[model samples]
Target: MGLVVPFEDKNPDKGASIESLVSLVSADMERVNAMILSRTGSDVTMIPEVANHLISSGGKRLRPMLTLAMANLAGYHGDGHVKLAASVEFMHTATLLHDDVVDESDMRRGRIAARIRWGNQASVLVGDFLLGQAFKMMVEVGSLRALDILSSAAAVIAEGEVMQLAAAKNTETNEDEYLAVIRGKTAELFAAACEVGPVIAGRPKAEQAACRSYGMNLGIAFQLIDDALDYGGTSANLGKNVGDDFREGKITLPVVLSFRRGNDDERAFWRRALEENEASDSDLETAIAIMHRHRALEHTIERARHYGAIARDALELFPKSAIKDAMLETVDFCIARAH
Candidate 1:
């Protein structure tokens, strides 16, 4: 997770409302720094450095922004949104820390990751510290509803990590299984981000539910498109060298689609590459060729569009406002990556 928003459309105007709302989210991040720093104190030089390293690194911070924007759209004017939003960011950062250790990723946002820079031990403990901090912040917010939202999201995220481990190899990772993992790993956080805002704002239950659904769909679409890009997009456009999934013997959207469309021999090639952990250049070329032949990229794009639309529809329950417009822009940004 480099701060680079590879999935966003080149069009600046796509999700103007969400972007505008995100401006406030950015300001709130500063507040987050103050909160974290005061808690860490002078003894923790490495804590501050690692925290800054991860926070300052380029990131979309999309989840926290959703928190702020939904709060605004739902007519919540309190300052607590800032604290809650920061808590959301902290939770996300903790996840990134854990994900890196699990994935063994060396780079994020084109820089050596925290785990890489400070060592895995530092990364793991710091991640735990942040998770504890995030909960503390949530408790300060004093909203059981907010706690419920984040706690549920955390549980779902853990389920996703385990699900990925279980589903890592073998061709059984169908669209449904893929969707389930996406929901658990990515969409749950997105939903948590948006839901916290409305819950804190004391919004109507229906509206809050819609925003959660909207974020979930948006997250799903975003992750699916990312999986597609791993097979097709350039490293410059997609960021973080592609093919890590294939290297790790993980099956993603394009691979699944390609195998579905491949002939017996072609399918056998995938079986050997994925199941046996052996893939040659010819195998890579064949997989790429197969994805292209069956238009898997296009298929993935269409799926992303479907989710973007659902995200937009989630905003329909809200009255027209600058915030709503920004939310819509974010939806477009999510789908326009491939467009």
Candidate 2:
């Protein structure tokens, strides 16, 4: 049931460069881009305008690429992958729009957030529109299995958002609780995106499971690196202002670890800074210092590497080829984002 990928070389720290992955799926991605543009259009005009605002903005489009690449890796030659890829992107975009509104965020991808540009109402409505469009495309694909996977993911993502809301500014949120939220909010979609490729490709259950496993673990690593980077990264690294998480009082692994290890005075600082939302400019600096003293950020990255390794290993079912190598390298790249 396993397929062979084009494996040329190996540099575990770095392999299968992103450029190569993009190149491998370039033609299919072009069709996906067209689908995205066409489906976003509407007579209301604002629909397309607001949709394009984020769609046209420079995003790596990594999620869709994963769908397309996984399909290729499974030896799929159908046009359905293009539609599925677009659906994945739309789902991801919808979440971003909703997330910014929920987080009361001002910026996304280095510009003022859509919520700010058009207001929260527009952002939310457009996000809903995108979700509707995503489901429509999934139906058009006519893969009941794929639809079930992605449709369920939408619900899980919503649940994850609510779980995060409940955990927000609550220092008692443990590591397991935080992991559950991310697995739902982030990893669910990744797993679905990768799983559907093999489902449509008619690969065996084992292969489909492998792809799902790869995506789920890769997504966790990606988010973990992001969590660490929020406290320790620069604007360039984060693609948005640093300290946004701290400023918003979002509970992430670094905060959880630091809180668990801190002394009473430090615990009080977390309570005031996070629970009370009293984080001053200097507080972010102090927070980083505490995280460093507690080895929080470093440990977060270490956790990411652990997941990245599992992601890499998930693909061991597939024979070595360039695509498999690239997929494996993506895990390394996700962890490397911390640097």
Off by over 4 Å in 1: 1-18, 24-30, 33-42, 280-283
Write down the RMSD of all candidates, one decimal each: 3.6, 6.4
Model 1: colliding residue pairs: 2-109, 3-58, 3-59, 14-329, 15-329, 15-330, 17-325, 17-326, 18-326, 18-327
**C-alpha lDDT (0 to 100) for residue 277 of candidate 2:** 91
Question: What is the TM-score of candidate 1?
Answer: 0.90
Question: For residues 1-339, what per-residue lDDT tens digits would candidate 1 score against the true structure?
Answer: 121223323334242334565665566667655775565443678887887788777777777778877787788877777777777888888888888888787766657788988989888888888878888878988899899889888889989988987888777578888788889988899998888888888888998899898889989988887787767665555546666677677777777788788788888888898888888645665666777778776677777878888888988988888778777878777766553
Model 2 Cα lDDT, one tens digit per residue, 98-167: 9999999988887788999899999999999999999999999989999999999999999999999999
**lDDT winner among the candidates?**
2
Q: Over the full model, what C-alpha lDDT does candidate 2 score relative to the true structure?
A: 0.89
Per-model TM against the reference: 0.90, 0.95
Per-model C-alpha lDDT, please? 0.77, 0.89
> Given candidate 2, what's the lDDT at residue 254?
95
